[model samples]
Target: RVDFTKIVEEQKSLREDFNKLREDFNKMLLEISELKKGYGRLERRIESTFNAMISGLTDLSKYAGLTLEDFTRKILENYLKGMGVLPSDRSLRSETIDSEQIDIFCEDPAIVGEVTAYAESTKEAEKLLKKASVVRQKLGKEPKKYLLVMTTNKQVYKDIQKISEENEIELIVGRVV
Candidate 1:
């Protein structure tokens, strides 16, 4: 009761449809593989960029004659100027008051500051605070206290920040531009 020619034609059409779908599926798989390879390449590039940046920062820190204090002061000087807080008279004294030296003294603003190359420990932060306290005592005035640190460790930085806040000290963190 079935027509033989019609049945044969239907079988041929079905085979053509299957072939097209299989071809499309293979193309999709190839595209996905290419995308995966591209993603891998992108991830490697990002990691390489980060490593290069860290190395560059390390090299910057090791450069001679540009101590952490010097670097922070250089930046702070510009910042003060921008804030219109320029010192009418800047004094740099090497004299030690109880083994602590005031790194910078601004006459007009009566600002005293301590600078450190690296703040890697709470001990270092305490040392800076002690220096500020000593300067205040020697100056016999409650001069605006400043702590400038080039911090390499996150935990130390946090500790320093907390100490600075408690002591009402202005903390300036130096970093690579």
Candidate 2:
């Protein structure tokens, strides 16, 4: 005789097993969705942090530049005073004339100069020469001296030095930063 009870019991067990597997798969999907959301949040946080760091760095760079300009101006003033080019009361300063900004400028005994934290190429020297030319054109008189001061320089210092000499731009370098 055929055993109908056994077949029915086996079908019930198979149905239960299928239900359990489906439940487990749904739980795994939920976990994967939560992980994806977490990953998105983490990405946003990292991007925000990176942007903040870049902004802070930019501000710091500007502050450092202004500080260096002040330091260069003081040194140039003292040196020129010692050399008898600048008067005791007069001071070197930054000026903008006809939209051209001069990093270092003096009225009496005309002088034009630029200050940089670091210079790696001769183009820097050439740029200062061009600025001097613009200042001369705007003022309708040639400056007595054109100066290029750098806190540090790379291997191209020799080429820059040559350009400075040929163009009569006094190059002054302090200890490397």
Alpha carbon lDDT of residue 109, candidate 2?
Answer: 69
Task: Give per-model CA RMSD.
Answer: 13.8, 21.3
TM-score of each: 0.53, 0.57
Q: After superposition, how far is residue 168 of candidate 1 from its true place, in Å?
A: 1.2
- After superposition, the stretches of candidate 2 with alpha carbons farther than 4 Å from their true spots are 1-66, 146-148, 151-154, 175-177
| Candidate 2 residue-wise lDDT at 120 | 66
lDDT of 1 at 159: 76
Worst 10 residues of 1 by lDDT: 87-96
Total clashing residue pairs per candidate?
A: 0, 0
Show the lowest summed lDDT stretch of 10 residues, model 2. Answer: 50-59
For candidate 1, list the clashing residue pairs, or say none. none
